[model samples]
Target: MDDQQVGAAAPLAPTERTDYAAADSRRLKIILAGEAAMLVAAVLVVFVLKIVTGTGAIAIFAAIVTINALIMTWHVRVITNRGQHQARQAPGGK
Candidate 1:
């Protein structure tokens, strides 16, 4: 591919992640807590359903998938918010 083509495929510099761990400290902890709570809730729900219905392995697999989806959605939101936060802090964002 030509340089222009390659450049087009690359993420914009502003959205390119330099650090995954950087964000408002307090907010980051809150996000972590929320994510953890979600994980716990998902697992608890799956386990409870399995026990109540005797659904066995399928229920466990469903729980894993559900929990993974929840976590992934949360992660995407966190990243987007973090990027927006960073952008707002940037001089041009104002």
Candidate 2:
């Protein structure tokens, strides 16, 4: 085989695989951190409201529902966008 064919058939280098793994890990960490931050902020808001307004269990329940809804919305949007992007990159996509 010619040099070009040989090079094209070569598997990814160890460093290239490592780089892809590291990037995926970093992205996962960042996403988790953002989610945690949102939950923490929601807890803090609920805590302060409970102390000041003396709102009961319903407020906490509402806060949990709101946070879950927001998270679900975010995930759905991300999934949709990723699907659209992949479709655009597929063969014969316009």
Candidate 3:
């Protein structure tokens, strides 16, 4: 065999563990779910406030919550992509 083949590293055992794509995927799912929950909470808050107090500013609050949700959704996607990219570029990322 050539030097390259002879010097190749052996594969890991069946019991070996590594943190990579699975962790990232889990984190992404959590982030997405959390954002969705927040959106639902915001909507609930708007309805509750409206029913309990009949406030005229309900629309404003709802608008704010929707804007917040949109912004946060964008932010989470950006962060998730950035983390994945950085992880890939990190030394021994796999």
Identify the candidate with maximal TM-score: 3
Top lDDT: which candidate number? 3
Give the Å shift of residue 45 in candidate 2: 0.2
Report lDDT (Cα) of residue 66, candidate 3.
76
Tens digits of per-residue lDDT for model 3, 1-94:
5433665554433233135455666777877787778777877887788888888656767687778778777867776786666555554545
Residue pairs in candidate 3 whose N, alpha carbon or C atoms collide under 3 angstroms: none
Global lDDT of each model? 0.64, 0.63, 0.67
How well is each residue in 23-49 modelled by candidate 1, as lDDT tens digits? 444556767777677767767877787
Question: Which whole-number lDDT from 0 to 100 does residue 64 have in model 2?
Answer: 82
Show the lowest summed lDDT stretch of 10 residues, model 2: 2-11
Candidates, ranked, TM-score:
3, 2, 1
Show where candidate 1 strays beyond 4 Å. 1-23, 56-94
List TM-score per model, in order: 0.43, 0.47, 0.53
Which stretches of model 3 miss by more than 4 angstroms? 1-18, 87-94
What is residue 83's positional error in candidate 2, in angstroms? 14
